[model samples]
Target: MILTAFLTAAVLVASGGTATAAAPGTVAASDREVQFVSDGVPAYGTLHVPAHRAGARVPAALLIPGSGPTNRDGDEPPTVTPGTLKLLANALDQDGVATLRFDKYGTGRTGLGGLDPAALDLPTFTRQAVAAEQTLAKQPEVDRDEVSIVGHSEGGLQAMLVARRVRVKSLVLLAPQDLRLLDLLKIQLDAQVTAADQTALSKVITDFRAGRELDYTGMSTQLATFLQQAIFSPVNTRFVRSDDAVYPPSVARPGPRVLLTCGTQDTQVPCWTTSPLAAALRTLPRPLPVDHFQHAPGTRVNDQVLDPSVVTALRTFLEHR
Candidate 1:
């Protein structure tokens, strides 16, 4: 479920300090360290703002990370090599857009984010996102009403959740998933199981639904461990029950602007599964304004976030009228 743009991290300072925001042609640190409390847990974030220009305030976005141990930059390495989000933040700053990217539970300085990993739940992430959004909105450099939520992978799904609950300016979903939590898991796991082990895996899913013990008698130790920790873990059941989280129709209405990006080669949350997020926006009850771009030339992604195409496309999308 580590489904973000399979991306990477930030260039935040070790403690609260300021950095020079880069000129478009330059690559500067571009951010300030900020703090927000989620569910009473202290969460730290990197706030990327345009260089203070004549006391101007720019639109802000909350950059949310995907699942597992993804850092503020969208990376959970060994599985990814900093593809999408971190670069996107820098690109946005150059465009005069401010952004806030937070470290999720069990990651970076937030390390546990004041929540025990063993007792974590999906709400923890949602709370963190919302809290971070609220925190960003309070910044004097931000236009509160224009604060948007940009989520990659699972972060995209989380963005949908935030949109429905909060009155935000827009949404940006990067390789956002369309399937229900458990169903997506089933498909992904099925790909790994052999025809010989199909029955056993099927039984495991059945048992999980029925709240029975998982019997991994003949399964490889690695696979079994994966199933136990990632799939059947008690910490994630609430999400499994959310029924595909939010779908396209749900996101179609009541938002300022929505940009959905798809990387043609994204295998984890294949951009094709959801019938193009743009379609949902186009067919909305109110026919909302939408912008989307899929790398038609089939860009090869390093994880889900590192593609240069993602940064370029996003900069264009944000700059579009």
Candidate 2:
């Protein structure tokens, strides 16, 4: 079963490292290998179904990855091999909820012929997400009307766009940013620079805004390009303006049940940034329930750190609703 496999993996990971395994009661009941096709590209994922709900169709969640090359398990560059989503999926499975977590386009086992991160725009990602949703809806054990999406970070933006085009039942956003793409990137860069030199950081921001590439004598071309894209790309600017420009009143179609979460320590997308997003959603003149969950005892600016409690909250939300 999926839960059993996760327990086995947890035991192995815990025994081999300083990390603690999930408490016995927190493990899932079962899991299985599942795959789907998106735009002729084969996408792979794992479907964790609660053991108690065997033979019964259940509410389902599509787990969308954050930015970069994060795979189905939420692992990305500089942090390879961590199965964050897998662990979350297992925990949710224990609660009689099924989760489908897949790799972003051109990542993991998905075909890469037409995939290029640098060339990708918001709509491209949204289309892929919608395809993934439809694929999940067609599964025999998934209740189409009860299917929702749980997107983390940038994927949260993608989830919102996807919802506009699909009939998702609910949405859960984790540490989502409400700022325009360029502004968010500038904030992130400033934070990183402050760790070293405030003066240099300010200069770098000025240079970026002025369209001058920063000096990267010691940095690789890849890192340089990434920084450039983060700061100057029209893609990010457009995404931000488009999202902000949405007329909330026009989106009044019985909105999906929404849950927005952020960590107190999340530096990449700080609580302050996430608060505005939740506030904006609350302003929508619709009759939908919107909830916010800010992690207690929040850490300082390390959004990459995985908190098991977040997973618990997600499971509770999906199961009870």
Candidate 3:
């Protein structure tokens, strides 16, 4: 049941028209561009260092990109104002913490390896993030033992997997989905299509849950197949079913702290998705501190820029601990 829903969501994203904004080449004086080879391909990133960290090693964060082709600066095709990770990096830098934000496997200035997005799996995603972390840890200005991961959206899942395998000091998850991939996908599709006034979402979800192909009106055939491959693929099923708590609190070496954040107005990854994950973590025998922050949406808002409050919260969390 979960597998079906997961596949459907993957399909929706593949066929969805969420655009990426163009990358802007602006940076503060303390920040510099860096590149490293991941899986033999060069990946681009920006390293933001604090001005006061002239000789002292500073706490560092590896900013993980969310789903899709978002660039190192968090700018996507459709719009450009928010500059997601880029904004976070600047804020952290100002607060005396160093940060590294990079493009995903095939996005921005990074090279694409001829891999189809429909065929990409969680393991592949995890590897990219781990490589990024490894790259950042080797930097002279970054305190290797004090480094942490700040993963947003799908990146949160990847960060968890990496932390379990590597020695890291902490983790920060933003609007992470704790449910099985399939279930999360189903909910997302239902909400998105319903908001769009598309009646086909209901039929598609029903058919998908029954382990059947979804033949809905108004869905293009190309999109239909793409969705099928993305959602129902064996790769995605294995990811959602795997035991992810290998680094349980009872035995987590070099035990890392954790912080989770969600926006009340975020329909994409609502607060409900994070609550269960937080609850489950609390039940662990050697649980680390889990902090939660909720941002209330404003009526008149700035869409093209990062929320100042969110950045401030992140700065405080990453720098203090």
TM of each candidate vs. truth: 0.78, 0.68, 0.70
Those runs of model 1 whose alpha carbons end farther than 4 Å from true positions after fitting are: 1-15, 21-30, 77-83, 217-222, 234-254, 276-305
Off by over 4 Å in 2: 1-30, 114-118, 194-226, 229-254, 283-308
Which candidate number would show the highest lDDT if scored against the true structure?
Answer: 1
**CA lDDT, every prediction?**
0.63, 0.58, 0.58
- Note the clash tally of each candidate: 10, 5, 13
lDDT of 3 by residue, 170-208 (tens): 887776656555556656666644433235555665665
Winner on lDDT (1 vs 2):
1
- Tens digits of per-residue lDDT, candidate 2, 12-50, equal 000121222344444334455555554444555666555
* Model 2 root mean square deviation, Cα atoms: 9.7
lDDT (tens digit, per residue) of candidate 1 on 167-212: 8988877766656566666666677777646667777767766778
- Give the better candidate number (2 or 3) by lDDT: 3
lDDT of 2: 0.58
Candidate 1 whole-model C-alpha lDDT, 0 to 1: 0.63
